[model samples]
Target: MQYIYAMMFALEEINNSSTLLPGVKLGHHIHDSCSLPAWALQAALSLVGGDMPSCNSAAKYEEEKGIGASKGDQPVPLIIGGCNSVTAQIVSRLLVPLSLPLVSYTASTPSLSDKQQFPNFFRTMASDVYQARAIAQLAIKFKWTWVGAVVANNDYGLMALKVFQEGIQRAGVCLAFVETLQRENIVSDARRAALAIQASTAKVILIVAWYTDVMELFLQLDKLNVTDRQFLASEAWSTSSDLRQSTFSHKVASGVLGVAIRSSTLPGFDTYIHNLNPLLRPNDHFLKEFWEKEFGCSPGIATASPFASLPPCNGTESLWAVNNLFTDTSQLRVTYNVYLAVYAAAHALHSLLFCPDVNSSPGHNITCSFTNQIKPIELMEQLSKVNVTTPQGEAFNFQGADITGKYDLVNWQSSPEGQVQLVLIGLVNGFDLHLNESAIQWSTGSSQVPVSICSEACPSGTRMATRKGEPICCFDCIPCADGEISNTTGSTQCVHCPSEFWSNAERTACIPRQLDFLSFNETLGITLTAVAVSGVTVTIAVFVVFLYYRQTPMVRANNSELSFLLLLSIKLCFLCSLVFIGRPSAWSCRFQQAAFGISFVLCVSCLQVKTIVVLAAFRSARPGAEALMRWFGPGQQRGSVCFFTSIQVSHYFDNLSFTPDSVHIQWLSEVYTYYISY
Candidate 1:
């Protein structure tokens, strides 16, 4: 009813203005659609080609004033009706073949944007495409990976649900369940939807439905006492006053986040509504019905009136005495849309009637040369190009058949009186949503945002392993593998560490591996060093004793020179072991192996010489053994020892070319044991 008044208000404002549509008056023929697509289509057909029924005051006034009285005359050049998407679609399809234009105030289905289907359709409201994107973005911004959905079983709800699913899927959000509500079977559907909401683990639910259907669903939800889940609403029922004032508002609508159509207060609309009286327009049945319903009185003079049993209306009943949705003009969203729709149609007509001629001379006055025979096709063309600035200083123009999307993010908050209030918390322009999260109030009466995810995020040191046959949000945390690390939470995979680096105990990060070497500070190094030093000292003492006894028969017979050489070699071997004890460097790594190998070889060569000399002495008692003694003399023994030792030294130093930055402890221990056995 307010929507009708809004259109009348805009039409009245336009007709009285001399600057626009000069010396021209626009008359309207109103029809009641009853929110039915069939009725809306019938009304549209009657306006275009059928007879104008004199059922309302506006039609009678047009008839008596001869504004468009001829039987063949097309009184309505354009239409501004069909509030819902289904109605708009039906009427537009009917009007398209006849070249009629329709400017809807609130029909916002995404399918209406198809120029091929709704070529002559223009709407003041933004399409559901933008609304779906805004809702999806809001969920993603808050990291609500898992959520439930409830949509009406109609074109509007189904289309919005489809688009929303696409958007959320792209962002990796998953739905726990999707429930559809049928207006025809609202009782059963709402019960099922409520049960789905109650049983689901999702803490948030997205509801895309009309006001009445949503109201029914909320009633069921209230009966079930489902108060823990937060609901995300579409523009259709987001700011509906009926829902706000419903009995279940506190139980089911608290902490509801919604994307509402952008709205502004329409100037003079409140006064226009207050000044309405059935007596002034007695032929208008809609006004009488509104008056009776609002004042709860019988305004009809007939005895068969439905409201005859109620109190009689005095025609002086003030509309301000009662507060209702009809008179409430605080947030004029759909009303403002109606106003824009009317103005757009008027502007398009003005452009068509007073079009400037391209062939006219410069500075010549453009004439307003238009008859009442205006074609709907020409008006549609002009409407496509019409750009109008609203009274609130906002400007908009049609991109194709729809305007750019802009929405207000509203949250249902409880006032001090326990009434649900739609609080402005953010704005969405196009696909971008600017939200004030701190201002949001959750269903739990906390300032914290609600959690809605299938699984908790994997912490650092772990990677996410998705559960089979489930959504990506449902996952398990697995510890990182050895030599791998996961630095951040919710990591999908672990990264292998670099060769020189190794994973920490927690597997959260990579760190340098410990350098392996036999250091002098450890117990093993001290024990080995003490033993090596003692062996060298004992060898030196034996060498000194042998040298002191060089003149004795025992010393001469035992080959003292060879023994001294072997002692020197044994000292070299013992000192080489020290090279392996400290932190290994390039020189120590090369010299340790070479020194051990050459010293051991030299000691073995000297022992061989001593053994041969002893055998030669023992064989001297046999005949012809003197020749063997000469061959195994002191000079020969020295030559043999020197030649073999030189060969071993050269071989050991020649092959020393390998170097390493660091060595593993296990590998170093194995190499040390092998060398000791050798």
Candidate 2:
């Protein structure tokens, strides 16, 4: 009823304006669709066929002008009706053959955007494509990775669900459940959807359904006592007065974040609505019914009226005294759309009737040459190119068959009086979302945003390992392996460090490896150095003592030359062990091994020569042993020792040819074991 009033208001506003369509007056024939596609289709057929009942001012005007004298003439040039997508689609298909333009105020199905399918269909409200993307972006902005969905079985809900699913899938968000609701089975479907929502772990649920369907769902949800989860609403029922006035609105709808069609206050619309009275328009049956329903009074004393049981109307009931959907014009969203649609039609009609260059001469009087019968096809062509601005400074134009989409992000917050208040928290234009999160009132009654995810984010030093048979969002945090690093949080894989670098203890970063070598400053190296030095010192002292006692009888008997040589060789062996204690270099490594081997062989060879001389001396005491003493003289013994020592030196030099310039410190243990066995 308010929509019809808005259309009438626009028509009257245009008719009174002298600058636009100066001599022409626009009239409207309104029909009640009862929110049914069949009724809407029937009404459209009557308007196009000129067989409509003469119950409105438009029919009276047609009768006065004899516009319907011919059966072929189309009395209605255009139509603004079918507030929902299903009815809009039905009406659009019926009007296509007649080339009649059908401008809808609120039918926002994305399928209607196809120009080939709905060429003559134009709408003041944006299509559902933008609304779906806005809802998807809202979920992503809040980082709600896991959410449930409930959609109506109609074109508006199903089409929006398709688009929204596509968007969330691209963003890697997972749906915990998807439930569909049909008007025929709304009660059962709503119960099922409510149960699904209750059983799911998702803390946020998206509902893409009409006002009536959502109301039923909310009733079921309230019965189930499911008030903890937040709801994301589509534009269909985001600002629905019926839903807001529902008994369970506060319990189920509070803290709901939704996208609503952009709205603005229509100037003078409030006063115009307040002044409505059935007595002023007693012939208007719809207005009479509206008055009867609002004030609980019948307009006339007719028994055939549905409100016949009610009290008689005084014809003086004030609309301003009653606050209802009819009189409340504060957020005139759909009403403003109706106003725009009417203006658009008026502008198109003006362009078709009045041409600027029909009389070019200044002396000639400017007049329109159009007939009283305006063609529907011609009006449609003009409507396609219609562009105008509203009094509130908003630019209005059509992008293809629909206007550009712009929405207000609203939150259903609890007011101080315990009523649900639709608070404007953001704006959504195209894919861009400007949100004021600080102003948001959450369902938990706290400042913290709700968390909806399958798993927590992986911290640094770990990578995300996806769980089997689950969504990507459900993952485990696995620490990086040794020699690998994951510096960033939630890394998919760990990267191997460079050759000279190794991972730190936490495996979060790479650092240069420390050199592994025994040094003299360390405890083990110092102990080895002291032991080697002591052995060298004691051997040197023994060599000196043996040399000092060379003329003594005991020393001479013991073969003093061999004994002094043995002491010197033992001293050389002890000094060579010191070479193994410090940081190894190319020259020190080769010299250490060669010196140790050669000194060890010379010491053992001296011992053998001394034993042989002792045997020779003992044999000289026996019969016929004088020759044995001569054979094992000092020169022979010394030669034998020198020969063995020289052989060892040659072998050391031979091995040096195959050895590397610098041995790895890691191989030092193996080298020590091999030389100790020798």
User: Which candidate number would show the highest TM-score if scored against the true structure?
Assistant: 1
lDDT string for model 1 (48-151, tens) is: 76465541235311100111212233354578776788888888899899878888888899899999999999998999999998998888888999999999
RMSD of 1: 8.0
The 0-to-1 C-alpha lDDT of every candidate, in the order given, reads 0.80, 0.79
User: Model 2 scores what on Cα lDDT?
Assistant: 0.79
Model 2 Cα shift for residue 84 (angstroms) = 1.4
* Model 2 quality (TM-score): 0.74
Give the alpha carbon lDDT tens digit for every residue of 556-602 in model 2: 98988888888988888878767777666667767776777778788
Runs with alpha carbons beyond 4 Å of true place in candidate 2:
53-74, 296-304, 308-315, 357-369, 518-678
lDDT for position 236 in model 2: 83
**Candidate 1, lDDT over the whole model:** 0.80
Cα lDDT for residue 390, model 2? 72
- RMSD of each candidate? 8.0, 9.9
Pairs with backbone N, CA or C atoms under 3 Å apart (clashes), candidate 1: none
